[model samples]
Target: MAYYIGTNGLAAFSVINYLHAFMFLAFLGIGSTIQPMISYYYGARKPEMIKSTIRISELTVLSLGALFILIGFFGADFLVSIFGVASDTIADMAATGIHLFFLGYVFMGINFIYMTYYQSIGYIKPSVGITVFRGFILLILMLLILPYFFGINGIWLSLPVAESIVAVVLMVYARKGVMEQGTFERRF
Candidate 1:
């Protein structure tokens, strides 16, 4: 699509993707930190501890997500500039893509939190399902489908759409378990 859009689009995408890589790594770090802690608490049969851990992790992740949204929304030009994107066209594309793409961060952390939560609690299938949907299935579908309709803006919108959908599904699936007392057993 970028090739169709020309060199400026490709350059903008490259810069945005590079910055996205850093943001993704931070998301992974949050997941890594919570996974082990959740597993340990669950193993100890400490439901309250697990609840507390999740609360803290969710707060932290949401805060980070908010920060990311702010930066992506307001600091788009600065972010592009850091990569030395001097061309106005390229910079505008990068900044626009950044603004649109980072909307995913608002819900991205929820997907990560639940995916890691399910994995830590020994619910492998749901964990894997969430991971696959977020990382591949929904992403590929949106990447393929969205761009066909909206062109370049659709490409920018894909990740946010996929992430938001998965997050909603995960939340709905986990809702029953969340309200139940005792062990966080699998519902489906």
Candidate 2:
């Protein structure tokens, strides 16, 4: 979107995209470390252990999300500088994007935990469905919608909006098990 709006040059855009991909992988690595600890423990009927693991995941995600938002808000230029973004307007747009992008992470923590819970119970289809909606569908929507409204900023804002919706949907789906018994075996 930045490239489309002419705020970022091709080379700078490519570098920034690479950095984003690297950060995504880093986040996945960190998440992978904790997900199995909760999933396997919960699957084995260790309910108390699962609760403790959830607390740990919450704290870790909160800390990381806060730090990321702070850096993205305050140091956006420093990051774009690394990609050699020379235009002031482009730098400002990148900074705006950084700050707005963090909102998605806050909602993502909730969605991720819920998705992991579903996955832990062997409800792989629902879990994958949620991911498809949250990932590709959201991306496609942003690609199609944001450019018309907010231009580059719209692209940045689309993420949190999509994530917020997905989280709400997941939460609503979760409530279907409220009248049932047990964790994974609860029927809707």
Candidate 3:
């Protein structure tokens, strides 16, 4: 990204990296809060309880995602300003990136919820697939492709775009599970 977009872009991305670390921590905390309860329900074979737990957790995360987007959108200037970049150009770049990059927060919550749900239910494949896809594959693909079209903005969009794609796939898979067997099973 730095290579494609230059030094200023790298500096802006550094701000994003810092911001994303915080987001990751919050997501991890949410996952930690939900995982144990879901795991217990699954172990006890309480499918209804598991369903309820997953549902509530998903909602909680989605709400958090919304909050994150607001922080990134409305607070973009302040958020970037906090970094004390010497150049207005860098600061503006970071602010713009924040607005674009934070769009992923909407989908990221559900992706984590699904990953947690799968892990809790002993379905390792989907969990791993979700992690690998979001963390590596989709990220790389989006970085490689989005830039070809959207230029610098595409670089900013890489994370959210990858996350949104994974979330869609997860939602479709979960919906299929609910429709087919009346509940999500330990499968893809």
Tell me, by lDDT, which candidate is best. Answer: 3
Clash number for each model: 0, 0, 0
Worst 10 residues of 1 by lDDT: 175-184
How high is the lDDT of residue 122 in model 2?
64
Any residue pairs clashing in model 3, and if so which? Answer: none
lDDT by residue (1-188, candidate 2, tens digit) is 53566536344445445655654554565556666876787668876676566567656765766676787778877888887776786677666777787667666765666567667656777777778888889867876788687766677777777877887775566534421233545332
- TM-scores of the candidates are 0.92, 0.78, 0.94
**Candidate 3: lDDT over CA atoms?**
0.85
* Candidate closest to the true structure, highest TM-score: 3
User: Using alpha carbons, what is the TM-score of model 2?
Assistant: 0.78
Comparing candidate 1 with candidate 2, which one achieves the higher lDDT?
1
- Provide the clash count, candidate 2: 0
Greater TM-score among 2 and 3 belongs to: 3
RMSD in order of candidates: 1.6, 3.3, 1.6
List candidate 1 segments past 4 Å from native. Answer: none
Candidate 3, 1-188: lDDT as tens digits: 67776898899999988998898888888887888998897678777777677778778888989999999989999998888888998899899999999989888888888888778778888889999999899999999999999999998899999999999988888745633454545557
